[model samples]
Target: MADPKGFMRHARREWPRRPVGERVKDWDEVYVPGGVLPFVEQQAERCMDCGVPFCHEACPLGNLVPEWNDLVSRADWHAAAERLHATNNFPEFTGRLCPAPCEAGCVLAINQPAVTIKNVEAAVADRVWADGLAPPRPPERLSGKSVGVVGSGPAGLAAAQQLTRAGHTVVVYERDDRPGGLLRYGIPAFKMEKAQLERRLAQLRAEGTRFRTSTAVGRDIGAARLRARHDAVVLAVGATAWRELPVPGRALAGVVQAMEYLPPANRVCEGDLDVSPLSAAGKHVVIVGGGDTGADCLGTAVREGAASVTQVDIRVLPPAERDEAVDPWPVYPTVHRVSPAHEEAGELRFAQDPDADARLFAASALRFSGDGAGRVRAVHLGGVDARRRPVPGAERTLRADLVLLALGFEGPEVAAGGAVAELGVAVTRDGTVARDEEYATDVPGVYAAGDAGRGQSLVVWAIAEGRAVAAAVDRHLMGATSLPSPVTASTRPLRA
Candidate 1:
C-alpha cells in the first residue's frame, strides 16, 4: 500500500461505458477508449493486505492480488503485469469475463465496497500490452518432448504456452477453421473483442507453440495416429454438448442450439457472412436460460435488430445481495449482478418494446409451437415456484420467430464419436472425463484438463487446471520438474 486510508479516501469508480444509444448500433467494446489509467491505479490501493488474504484462497489460480495491488499503486506496470502473469496466463480474458470471486473474499468487502480488483487487473494488462512489455519468451533449449494439446480454448492455450515455455515442443489442434475456440466464436465481440485473443496467440506462435486449426483429431487423423506423433497428449476439449428442450416443435426451422446460433453470428463479425442465416433481425427472439450464455444471446439479438427479445429461466431469481446464511463469505455466492449485455438488452427493450420484460425469473418453458411453414412461431412458458412447480394459471405464450436455447451444457460429449471415445477415456456419471488427482487419465501418457476433465465450470478454474495439468505432464516426461503448482485437479474452495 500506497495509503492505508485509500479505501476511505476514494469512492469506487467504474470505467465509463459508451452511450447505449451509440453503442448498440455497432459491434465493439463498450468502454470508453482511454483516460482511465489514473483512476485504475488509485483503485489498486484499496487492498487491505489482510492477515490471511482470503482473496488468494478464493482465486483458482491463487493470483498474487495484494502484491500486484501494491505494484500497481506504485505505478510499476511492468512488475504488476509480471506478478499477474505468474498466476494467470490470460488476465485480460479473466478480467473481462470472470465473476471476480476474489473480490467476494476481499478483506475490505466485509464492511465496504471491495477494491476494484477486476478493473485494476484489466488496466495492468492493457497497460503492458500498449507499452510492449509483453513479449515472446521462447525456451532457451528444446526438451525434445513433443506434446499435443487438443482444443484451442483458454485451457488448451494456457497448457500449450506453459509446456512450450518449459522447452517442450507443443502443438495445439482445433477443429474450427480458426483457432481460439469458443473465445473466438462463442463469445460476442462486445464483451471481448477478438484482437486481444489474437495478440496473445501471436506471442504463443513466436514462442514456438504450433497450431493446427481446422483439423479434428479423431476426424482428420485417427486418435492413435495423433498419439503416435506426440510423446504426450493433453485433452482440453471443453464441455460443448449443450442441453436441449425435448418439447414438441423442437425440430422447427427457427429453433437452434445456443452454440449453433452463436458460432455463425461470430463468423459474421469476422466477415465470413454479410448476414447470419440465424440472424434475429426483425424477429421476435426468445432465449431459454438465465446464465451468461443467455445474456449473450440477449445482447446478440439486440445487435441483430430483433423486434423483441426475452429470456425465461426455470431457476428462481438470484438475491440482490449475497445470501449470508447459506453462502457465507469466501465462497462465490450466487447473487444478482447486471452484466454489460444486460445493459444493452435493457436499453433495447425499453426503447423498442415497452410491453415486454427482457428477463423472467421463476419461470419454465413448457413447449413450442410451429407455423404451417415448419418454422418456430411461439414458445409456451409458465411461472414456477421455488421448487420449480408450476404456478396456478400462470402459463402463457410468447411470440418467437427465432428460438435460441441458451441452456447450460451436460458435461463432456463423448458418445457421438470424438477423441475421448476413440482413445478409450473413462467418463464419470455426469459425463466428464475421469482423471486421477494428478490429472492423469487411465492412459499412461495422456492427460486431461479444463471442462473435459473437470466438467462445465468457470474460466478461472479452467486456467488453473490447465496450469496444474501442464506441470503433471512435465513431471511425467522429465521425471522431475520445476514448474509451479497452482492447484490439483480436485482443489477448489468449499462449494465454489
Candidate 2:
C-alpha cells in the first residue's frame, strides 16, 4: 500500500461527470476529460490488502485486484496494467460499463466506502494505452490448425485473441457491417467512445486475428460448411432477443424495442447515418423498465432532444442508501443507483410495489390511442395493484409521442428470420444455445459462449467465459494448452 493511513486521510472521490446540460448536446462520454487520474492513485491506496480479499471472489475474471491496487498505489502504472491484462482481455470496456461488484466486496466496505477499484482499473488501462505499453502478443509458432469464431462481441473477440496467440489460425464472423457486436453497435458512444473499441480491434488485427464482417452462419455460409472448412468453430453470439411487453397496444407504430432504438443512435455517432430512424427528437418519451438499458434510453433521448423523458419501473423505489440486512457488506447491493444517464435526466418514476411475482406494481399500459395522421399521440395507464389489477378510479392518459420498450431481453431470439434461426444452431428450452463443459454444442467442433450459453449478463462475465472457452478449444485443437480460465460455471458470488 502507498500509505497505511491513506484510507483514513482521504475520502473516496469518484470520477467527475460532465455537466448534464453540456453532455446532453453531444453523444460523447459523460466524464470530463483528465479529471479521473488525480484521485485514482489515492483511491488505489485505500486498498487494505485484506487477508481474504473478497473483491477477487466477487469478480468473474478473478482479476488480481490487490496486486494491481498496490501497483497503482505505488504509481507503477505499467505493472498495474500487466496485472490487469493477465485476466481481463478488455479492461477499457469493463472499466467504463461494468457495475463494479468487486468494490461491493471490498473489505473496506464493511463500514466505510470501498476502494475505487473500477476507477483505478480504468486509469491503469488508459495510462498503459497512453504510454504505448499495450502490445499484441503474436504467437511464437503457428500451429497450422484453424478455428472459426462466430460473433464479434466480447466473448467471440476474447476467444479469438487467445486462440490466435496460442498459434492457431483464427477467423471471426460478424453479421453486422462492423465488428464489436454490442460494443460497436448495441451500446451508445456516450458510455464508451468507439475509438477505444477501434484501437483494440487494431491490436487484434496486428496479432493476426482475421475478421469477416457482414457474414452470418447458416445464411451466408452453411454451419456445416463452416465447420468443415475450419478445424473448430466457436459461437460467441450474444443474446439479442429483447424481453417484450406482450400487453395490448405493443403493436403501436411509435412503440419500439430498446435494441431497435439503440443501434441507430450508435450509427449516428459513427457518421454512417444522417438521422436515426428511431430518433426521439421533439417527442415526449416514456421509457419502460428501469435497468441499465432503460437508463441508456433515457440518456439517448436527452441527447436526441426529447421534449421530456420519464423512466418508469414497476418495483418500489430502491432505498437511497443500502440496507445492510438485505444486502450485507462484500456483496453487490440492491440499492438505488444514479447512473450517468440518471444524472442527465432528472426524472425516475417508481410505480407502487406489486404483491405478485409477475404482477406489475404501479405499472399500467392500458392502451395506445393514435390520431388519424397515423402517429402515436397518447397512452392510457391504469393504476395497478399488487396483482396488476386496475384500480377502480386510477385510469389516466398521458401525452406520448414515443414509447421505448426499455424492458430487458428474455433470451436469444431464435424465431424464423431472426439472427439465431439464421445461424441454424440448436437452442435449449430456455432459448439459450446448448453447450457442454467445453462450450461445444451437440454439433461436433462447434462451440458457444457468452449470452448464447449463460443467457443475458454483464460484459465482464462474457469476457471471462470467452477466455475460459478459448482455453478449452485450444486444448482440443492441440494435444494440450496453457490459456487461463479465471472463472468456472460453478463459481457463484454472494450476489448473483
RMSD list, candidates in order:
1.5, 3.6
Instruction: Tell me the TM-score of each prediction against the true structure.
Output: 0.97, 0.93
- Pairs with steric clashes in candidate 1: none
lDDT of 2 by residue, 327-365 (tens): 878779987677888766663221122211111337567
Clashing pairs in 2: 243-409, 355-386
lDDT of each: 0.87, 0.82
lDDT digits (tens) for residues 1-496 of candidate 1: 6889888888888778888888888889888765468588778877777779989988989999999999998999999999999999999999888888898888888768888888888898899799998899999999989999999999999999999999999999999999897899998998889998999999999999999998887788778988899999999999997898898888999999989899888999999999999898999988899899998888888889888888777888789888888688768788876777777777656222242347777878888899898998988988899888989998888888988998888876697458788778889888888999989999878999999988878888888988889999999999987877788888866563
lDDT minimum window of 10 residues, candidate 1: 348-357
**Top candidate by TM-score:** 1
> Per-residue error at 308 for model 2, in Å?
1.0
Q: How accurate is candidate 2 locally (lDDT)?
A: 0.82
Misplaced by over 4 Å in model 1 are: 350-357
